[model samples]
Target: MPGYGAPQNNGYGNYGNTGQGNGYGASQPYGYPSPAQPAITVGDGLSWAWSRITDNPVVLLVGFGLWTVLTGIGVEASYTVNGVEHSYGLGIPGGNIISLAAILIGPIALAHVGILTSSGRKASFRDVFTFPNFLQAFLAILLSRLAILIGTIFLIIPGIILGYLFSFVAYAAVERNLGVTAAMRYSMRLLSDNVGLLLPFALIGFLLYVAGAITVIGWIITGPLVALMTTYAYVRVQGRDVARYPSQG
Candidate 1:
């Protein structure tokens, strides 16, 4: 696309979110094991799964869009690991340079998009990558990646687990204003409370990622789709009745 140093987030600028905090029972940052109790049934696997699915209807809808973006980006790159295995390439127009960069920058942009969902804001992938905010996102992603790297030292499975477990790191950075360690703790608490949902949702995320590969130009639409689904999941997990940001489309 644009040059290496091109800015990422100038597309949508601010989403005009005045919610800040304390509006609509959002004051308490840590509301795990919520006392208010939502209408959706949290009991029974079938009931719980259905509740989660329906509560976060945006997940399926948004996921479709995100998968396409991820797939398109993946397709643009060349998938190959050098003989030593230390080297990998995604084979996009930018070649290895952008590929390695995406490995680091992807999560940052993804986090911005995820946060936008939290506010119930609609944003393009281009919007998510907008300017200075991306720097914060990049930092948050780098911290999480470090944790995954630690897991890799132990074993491949451990690394995967670490990545999955810490998936919510973005939540802290984007929402609760938490640093890496705090964000990880926040994720752990949420995950512990809803292990079943977390596992399945993560699986769904992976499946969408894989599924998006069905087409080459899929990302233009899939990218937004994936972001939408993720935000839907977050809203559901937080026991939200309506999406954080109502859908404009």
Candidate 2:
């Protein structure tokens, strides 16, 4: 909503002389395949993310740190019940409302951060709350979470599969300005085509989460690292260039 500048045309349809790299390898013309361009791997995603974070740790750290503080405040607000401790509520608490607002809005902001950083542009803390299509982004996230929850209820594997499949919903919503259903559908389509290249990143992210949990403070790095990696994958899958930070072997 804020003056975040015109949206970059990074979608699959407008892949012209954008000058962004094709993916993890050397730059190639749009719609043409290069034999030398190696397939993107989980390590590539992580490495690329690490490079971006190291390049601009302050922006990423400040943005995520603000998110964490707001989330904590929301958590604290939700527990107050008529000024009594452990009191029950018939509906969701006000603090939960704040927390939910943060959760719904935070990822979109993080996505913008990753997108801008990948593009080698200056990303500011204001980028976090600058969603032009806030309603659409919110519904997109809510429905995707609901779908994932339902899938997990049926079976753990289905949930995981659906989770990865719809993981790009926020990117779609932010980048393409698509509505809830369209964003989810777009994510599904992209992942379906590139599941082989993308699934490992999801697995790697899970492992990172596990490792971060062990260290407790490790997620400050892992959290933004995963966001950066996912954005890189999204840009590459959409045919944008990301060779500036090449994936490591």
**Could you give the C-alpha RMSD of every candidate to the true structure, in order shown?**
10.1, 8.0
lDDT of 2 by residue, 141-199 (tens): 88888888999998888888889988888877777677788889888888988988888
Each prediction's TM-score against the native? 0.57, 0.74
lDDT of candidate 2 at residue 17, scale 0 to 100:
33
Please report how far candidate 2 places residue 36 from its true position, in Å. Answer: 7.2
* TM-score (C-alpha, index-matched) for candidate 1: 0.57
Superposed model 2: Cα runs more than 4 Å off: 1-38, 68-94, 243-249
**Candidate 1: tens digits of C-alpha lDDT, residues 49-71:** 33333444454335434433443
Q: In model 1, how large is the Cα lDDT of residue 6?
A: 18
* Candidate 1 error regions (>4 Å): 1-94, 124-126, 131-136, 150-153, 214-223, 242-249
Residue 85, candidate 2: C-alpha displacement in angstroms: 18
